[model samples]
Target: GKEQKQLASELARKGVTKEQAMRVKQLYEQQNNVNASNATGTDVNESRLREEMKENTSDMLEDHPSTQDLARSNQVFGRNIFNTRNLTFEPSVNIATPLYYRLGPGDEVIIDIWAASQNTIRQQISPDGTINIQKIGPVNLNGLTISEANDYLKKTLNKIYNGLNNTNDPTSAIRLTLGSIRPIQINVMGEVVQPGTYSLSSFSTVFHALYRAGGVSDIGSLRNVQLVRNGKNIATIDVYQFIMKGNIQDDIRLQEGDVVIVPAYDILVKVDGKVKRPMRFEMKKDESLSTLISYAGGFDADAYTRSLRVVRQNGQEYEVNTVKDLDYSVYKMRNGDVVTAEAILNRFINKLEIRGAVYRPGIYQLNGKLNTVRELVNEAQGLTGDAFLNRAVLYRQREDLTTEVIPVDIKAIMDGTSQNIILVKNDILYIPSIHDLEDRGDVVIHGEVAKPDSYPYADNMTLEDLIIQAGGLREAAS
Candidate 1:
């Protein structure tokens, strides 16, 4: 009871009522006492439990069910907090060709002479399997590797020099160097932002290559990322584990001219049928379907939450058997996944229609943003022809499932001012045809202007600028 009272005091300090705290403390003490008695341990129920709780006020209890679940599947290199990004782990040097190896045709090399820069070189063996150096002439080293070629060169140099200069220490003086293999560039495609050739000076992990290619696409997921090599799907890297658990093994080393493609975030849950807002939505980081749906504008009035379906897109397509709750969204999304919220028995969501003179004209996605029209217009290619640059409408469904349209202004775009608007996906932009448009601006006629319409939008016009040609702007004009 005294131990229970101390626990109550601790609880009081934590803003937890003393009554419930005392109750749980007593129950715990009784359970412990009974266990001790049965074991013949004669251990008394001391105040240690209360003291422990007090000492650990900042740290969460290991016994917390939430914490246990968090640690469920996060173990890399025996550390749950390992970072896959910076293995900081200089993995056992990936001696590409065992370091001091030789080079051949198709094998890259760098030769640097300590005494002379002209003699030192960084180049690949020619197709003819020969290298032409400044002083050494052409050396036939087609089949030899880096080491073999160096030895041959040393022997030849010694033979010639000893005969002429009478140097006894010929072999020991020559120091030939074979530079590292030329950097290997990998082709990165798919959903990456800056997709291009990335050089590989040394053996680097997948993440390193990705950094070179400018990180993954915004919609790309680290979880279930695929790395294909030699026209074969060699490995599927777990990006999340690399992220959460710091797994570096997944960051495999890359080879020359390897194509690293980042497919678009394919795993998507479709909010269709009866969802309040229907569209394809990406699974947020460390998020669930419950959170995702809420972000998708919650369940439609007719949405039957119990009948939700998660259709995932792999290479082709496959329907997940069934999903019980939002936690199912945690299932690593692949390239494409459609999550559908079935219509409820008695309710129905209203339909919206969009059309206009815009970049891409279509029934675009509707997120109910006032400026979403601008985004759709840009996507469709901006307004063409004689588009109504003045105003746009926001059509929304009322809680009663009825439609409401609100008009918006967009003249600021023409002036090259104001922020460009973001288009909600799937929006319809109507564009008419456009004719030629002309504009006249400030002008200066220093030399001549035949009809006085020559000077236009140009910078730093001087007397020489006016007389660009021997005849000037024109004979009569000048």
Candidate 2:
């Protein structure tokens, strides 16, 4: 009791009122079952209790967090989910067409010969990789490019169809054109949904081959996707660029022996705060901030998009930085970057707090002289399904610190029977939720009645009517 009095005196000296100090002392005494009247008890039980209390009090004091630690814990960059994983390739979106696409068997070619009599022949490369032209017989076109084949065919045809004119000079003209190119067999291996060799059109790209092989698997990394030609890595594919901005720079054309390798997804970045979906998203190398945001389902309606933050994963901690510019496409995202979208805090002097029974319940910006309760309600998407609009209360804090609770009948105002109330700054509009219909306007019957349950109160309801509705009085009724 002496120790409790000392603590109460300390609390009172530190600005706690006598009543609050007494309450705290009484609460402590009740919780610990300590008697203040016999504070200096020397019983063995009292000593043990005092020791336990001392141990618990010491532990609590020791566990109390410092201000600096609290501040650090409350920082926005805390709780980052990004992992530091080295990326292999930076995403690129500049695919150049293969200028020397090889000709193979099954490729069709058109040959035109003009010598004495014009003759045109359409032929396909046989399985032996040779084309049989009229008169010229078989010509090997295996492993030849379009330009090389054209040159080779024209030279051979011109020589065979050469016919001397009166001047004794060779007067043969030959035209060669490539028809349908043969489908190229591409091997799609690695972490794709289906890994196998697929025959795609000669014009098919790496993405097309991936599609033919059922695309990358769920655990596949689009950023580290590799295109290998003849056992050599040709290009890195970053599908995010194509997904976000329709960029196909890395969608290089596939060739025979080309392999589309979808490696396992290993890079991750975290996105939180004011976004439709806040979670850790897998990212490919060279993806921009805009792509990451799109992956997270874009910004929320309440997001302050003007300025967002990114917490870069440093060795043992995170480095937070704010990005004020809205052009996120140009900013390349790293693997361990945490993107955070801030919400607009109602810091302006002209604001209203609209709470409960509304689609959007928060602080709303108010315009002077022009802002009204109806306009604010409309901005909040009107009332919720269970809103009690008839009994809406508006709490206004006066300059002298006194609060005025004004009852509002929103249904009457909407029906044009009541005047529209103009709302001022700092007004708190609370729309109550609908209660159980049976509990509304109810009257409770006390003891001595047959049924002591509450009944719905009606205009001019007599005690006898209530008694009859409550199943009448019991025999012991007073």
Q: List model 2 lDDT by residue over 438-478, tens digit each.
A: 35478878676666798888878998988887878887886
Each prediction's TM-score versus the true structure: 0.28, 0.49
In order of listing, the candidates' clash counts read 41, 4
**Best candidate, TM-score-wise?**
2
Q: Which residue pairs show backbone clashes in model 2?
A: 1-39, 93-249, 94-249, 95-249
Model 1, range 1-478, lDDT digits (tens) per residue?
Answer: 6855675666555555445555566667676776666655344433554455554442423333343333331211112122335543333434445433434455556554433212445566776867776556777776465567666766665443332222563323344444444445677677565778766654556776666665666555444556777898788766655544576788876665567766655444455556555555544346666755665567766567774677764565576746776555564444355667776565223222356555455553445543454555554566666766666555555556565655555556545475654443222333333222234455555445333335554456665655552235655562
Model 1: CA > 4 A from native = 1-124, 127-183, 196-205, 228-230, 244-247, 250-253, 264-478
**Candidates' lDDT values, in order?**
0.54, 0.72
Model 2 regions lying over 4 Å from their true place: 1-101, 114-116, 162-181, 276-291, 294-298, 306-338, 346-395, 398-424, 427-478
lDDT of 2: 0.72
334: Cα error in model 1, Å = 10
